[model samples]
Target chain A: MRSVVSILDLSTSEINELMNVADDIERNPEFYRSKCKHKILATIFYEPSTRTRLSFESAMLSLGGSVISTPDSKISSAAKGESISDTVRVISNYADIIVMRHPKEGAPVVAAMKATVPLINAGDGGHFHPTQTLADILTIRRTKKTLSGLTIGLCGDLMFGRTVHSLIEAMLRYPDNKYIMISPNELKLPEYMREALDKAGVSWRETESLETAMPELDVLYMTRVQKERFFNEEDYVRLKDVYILDRDKLKTAKSDLAILHPLPRVNEISVAVDDDPRAQYFYQTLCGKQMRMALIMLLLGII
Target chain B: MNIDGVNNGIVLDHIKAGESMLVYDYLKLGRLKCCVAIIQNCQSKKMGLKDIVKIDELIDIDLDVLGYIDPHITVNYVKDGKLLKKRHLALPETLTNVIKCKNPRCITSTEQELPHVFKLIDREKQIYRCAYCDVVGDNK
Candidate 1:
């Protein structure tokens, strides 16, 4: 009866349980191969997304569940003016669970309200994306072997990076975790998130210099500096290359430092750094699948 | 000044004149199958002009709808030709199951079966936020 609407909805114990499940899935893949057996996962994506959609599909398929999907709503019944509720109602009858991604905020919440099956919000406009937060947590846990006592440096696009907000919210739950937010002044984190962090007693500092925070970071999470988010071309041009992680930038960073990026990178991360032992973005992608599998199993009541 | 009394009925006063039908439609008073009276463009000392809706049955008024349409309306409950209770309806704290958000990209706006839920996050500011998308809309 529970729905994955926001990261805040999951208690610390529930998140730990999900992480444990993800760890087990990573260690013993064969044991969970048929766990989902005859279950069906319905994916209703209202916006275009390649990685998120594919990850959900791959996760379900690997867990022995089939997928019923509308990859493009524009060409489907939605184009003819069918409501999201009607779509969810029809799909709910066919699928055992639903994963929804929409351009509008709260679209998945609406779907969850109408759907008889458990609903998972894949991504909703600039709002929450709980699954991505799960993936990031899994990656951080696997890399650091512990969530506490680490300085996590979040670099680039703080304002528009929905992942940054969710990650910040999740990380604040752990002890002795400090955040070093690196972004251009124009792309600073929203005041509300900063206030929330302040209220939670998490120590954080905002800075434009990535190199100054690089050496102290246990994890450096980089987000793409989206040009579209900028108000003008001049602003985009001036700040686009400000935070790119090159070999020169890595010289000051710790040897044990792990660099992570939610991918589809547009030159923010130099290709040369991909071979470094510290590069964990690709591994994070694999972790995304495992975490997603854990989520699907838990939501479907198969685990 | 001549106004007749009604037995076991509710009287709504202080509504902006000519807006009784909007309040009636917003409340869907006709669907209740109750005897209803809508008085429009009535002169008032405080409001200068006002409207009123009198219903024979005691029913819970939708305060969010009333708050959304016109916040100034006051509901007066009558019992046996005497004023039983008088209330000025206030906006709900958390609006669930009513009032669709106008944002096209809002999840509630697209979802057909889900009840449109909005929360009155900022009452003084007259701000209602969609429970899903967190988009803020002004009641005014």
Candidate 2:
């Protein structure tokens, strides 16, 4: 694909090919550090962000590429009502590739249409975060050393957790990847996603109880119940602390079980678990940078 | 039991019962200067009961909207009181600007010029999701 607007734009082999590149970069950092020597990476963020914006910038710098960025659209010309298409059209002239995050679900898609340079969607509202999925898959592949033959429990905010949605979709492409959806009934995944799993022949079951599903899981992907996504604060409050994972909860899980989160987390994961070797969220954060590196390299044909 | 046929016009047949007026209003058949006959809950051999919209003037009709509204609709072209062409409708694989995307955060919401596109994800369930954000559309 010329641009990565969605994870579905990538295939299983291409996913692996990128992982291989990320793996190599991890092993030989100095050798590949100067690969994007003369290139420019632009980060266009129309929404407030932390990890994703920093991750893309960090990835670009690690590749020895320079970056031009709009970390906040409020401060940019967008505040004066410049269109995303016009913004992308202007930015494509200055950057070799664009990594954009927007509060609107398909804003990057609109950017991808207008961009001459390749576009990478860092996160587009509650749509798809393909690069985050890349980090997720990379972390999962390295931690478990395989993408298949495991049960992954995606807990909390499944309804608005785009990462969970993207991760489930990406992981289902592999052989025998089972999913256990753990969430309150109010936050169950959309019916279409369940139907998609059914059509794909991926085995999955939904449960309200995390403790019930904990022992069987090989991986637990925890997501924050986002305050901004809620139309009602009461519903968010009721479901927010529904599944706080503490040491007591981890006692039932497998010893090698990997805990992953797309970070800047609110207490979905107890900081107590951060000390546990099973907590791979920090490593996943680092993988976020490496995966973006591999992604930029792939999109720019540096690999 | 013969319903009067139209000459040099269009006939929408086999529409789901009680949906003719919505179709009539949706297609904006009121704008037609010529005779427009809307026959609802008519006895049909194939469908048991159906709705028919007969336009006595040849006006541009959106087959996609008719198909999207009800896949079982049959569109017939008539000239000189003889049927020239007839076709049945099926659910469209993709739709543009037919239904507003329900997701508040969807691209179509903020990007006012963006086409609200949806792709049919489940044929049996007649389910369509917004192409941009994967938010399921109201298939109603």
Candidate 3:
């Protein structure tokens, strides 16, 4: 009866269980290959997201599940003026589960209200991407081997990065995990998140200078400074390359430190860092698939 | 022109004239067993145009829901042709429990069993944000 809507929805115990399931899937691929056989996953993407949508589809297909999807909303009945609730209600009758991505902030919530099956929010506006948080958590745990007692640096696009917001919420649940937020004043984390962190008693600091905080961080999580997110071209031009992870920055960071980025990079990370032993972005991408597979199996009660 | 007041009931006054139906739908008052009256498009000196609703019994009205739907509603409790309590419902500083946020990508929106909670972050702005997603949307 549970649904994976937000990273916050899963308690510490449930998250550990999900990570354990993901770990098991990573260790034994053959055992879960046919876990979702004959089941259908309906991906109703109202917005454009190639990687997230493809990963979900690949994860389901890898588990022997079929995908019924509209990769683009322009091609779907949504272009004909159908409400998300109406579309999901009809889709729920045909599919066992629904994964939705919408431009509007609460489109997934509206769909879940009308859906009879489990609803997964792929992305909703600038609000939340819980599955991405799962991938991030899994990657963090795999890289660090522990979720607690680490000084994590979240740099760039803090305001609009849904992944960063969700990840911060997830990490705040762990004890002794400090945060070093590196972003310009305009792109600082929202007041609500800062308040939540304060309430949770998590130690955190904000700095526009990433170099000052780099050497102390156990994990440096970088996010793209999206041009579309900026209100104007001038702000985008001024701050877009403020925190690029080049060799100079990497020299300041600890050799044991891991660098993570939610992919589809736009020059925030240098291509040269691909060979660094600490660069785990490629591994993070693979973890996304396995984590999604685990999520699919768990949701379908096959695991 | 004077509309006949209900014999003994709760009266919701000062609602935006055309928004009475929205308030009704928001409260799901149509499903209630109590007798109800929706007076719309009435002339008002203060608000230009106003609406009123009268219910036959005392029900626990969710003030947060009222705040979200129409913060202007003034609730009046009438007993034996006398106003017992006449008060303007103030929006909560934080809406912990009342009114589900309409955002699906929000955690509270997707989880079937979780309470649909929102907090009133700014009263003057008529803004309510999802406690889970931090998605802010206007109520008015």
Candidate 4:
């Protein structure tokens, strides 16, 4: 069975195909209802996640498919110390497809290897979140009107932000995509990522100030400083409030600049900016569900 | 200091100096019952100093491990006091259980039965990263 453990698992043409399906789903939701009539989707979350779990559930529901979920790990077999492989093998019997989120990076990879059905990695520690990249891409495609020839700004915790890493991987496949990575030196993008960008011959620059890169961005993807990924509380405390995207920051950005966040926001994004026309995070959430729907169907051979 | 030539075994030559112990440990030569000789810090015209390992009996050697440790090392197979073949090493495309990933957040940290897998990501730099977490493996 085909599974999506990383954003790289899908080719550029496949991503375009998924985006097309997502767009169609958004336009005609009723027409695509009952596509997965008798199929079952199992969301086995080893970590607490309201947004992603709900998105998968809603996507399955919209497709007229059944869902079996473990919303919290503390209550699941994982808390009893069951291995990801064993749990996934068991779950594969009950579900046609699986979407998982775990605190350990590569947990979903292990799950995918053992799963009899298609497995989707919703999030795996700080590794990959391919579906989130799909959602981000769909959002960028709709808002920016094109995936190429745009200055994409990735801000905040570039190091621990799985979404940022996945986005960079996905965006580089397109042509003329320049990345303006904004973050403190401590949270700079990993050397491998820099190497990938260099190998791809993509133009990218690093900066400590978001305002410096704001004006040139067509799409600005903001990420939270993940405290769980940090080794100590002191470092998390110091870096948490480093970059706040307030109205003042928006004033420096282009009017057409699309600000996107994989939400569950803290003070990193001022609430006042939510009302700004440029803010597309909420719309990004909607796109997330649609993309999940597209992905589920694609993996299940329904599309 | 001279070590006898192998009649029907393997001779590992041109190991970078100071890395012979690593090659021994990785090859698990200490576990073998066969006679194995390790010669270290020998002067050379090409290399300033090098190490050599000679085994008196034919034994399976993990060439990938040796290559990963040092690509310049060469493996000489001997049979009936004659050199059968000389094998050069290159960075392996992938390694399974050669080294464990140090990332605490990696799945291998919790899964006891999982094999530690790393892929050669940068051939020029000889960098290997964990297949699962993409964290760089400590080549040292």
Clashes of each: 5, 0, 6, 0
lDDT winner, 1 or 4: 4
Q: lDDT score, residue B3, model 3?
A: 62
**lDDT tens digits, residue span A40-76, model 3:** 9999987778899999999999899999987478978
Native contact fraction, candidates in order: 0.85, 0.69, 0.23, 0.73
- What C-alpha lDDT do the candidate models reach, one value each? 0.84, 0.88, 0.83, 0.93
User: Which ranges of candidate 2 are over 4 A from the true structure?
Assistant: B1-4
> Each model's TM-score?
0.78, 0.95, 0.77, 0.97
Candidate 2 local lDDT, A1-303, one digit each (tens): 389998988988999999998899899999888999999999998888888888999999999999998746777988988889999999999999998988888888888989999999988877788999999999999999999899999999898888988898899889998899999999999776787788888889999999999999999999999988888989878888998999999999999999999987898888899999999999998888988999899899988
Which prediction has more favorable TM-score, 1 or 2?
2
Model 2 clash pairs are none
Chain A: TM-score in each model = 0.95, 0.98, 0.97, 0.98
Q: Rank the candidates by DockQ, best first.
A: 4, 2, 1, 3
Candidate 4's C-alpha runs over 4 A off are B43-48
Predictions' DockQ, in order:
0.47, 0.67, 0.17, 0.79
As for candidate 1, its interface RMSD to one decimal place is 2.1
Report the CAPRI category for model 2: medium
Q: What share of the true interface contacts does candidate 3 keep?
A: 0.23
Candidate 4 clashes between residue pairs 3 or more apart in a chain or in different chains: none
Identify the leading candidate in terms of TM-score.
4
Question: Which candidate number maximizes DockQ?
Answer: 4
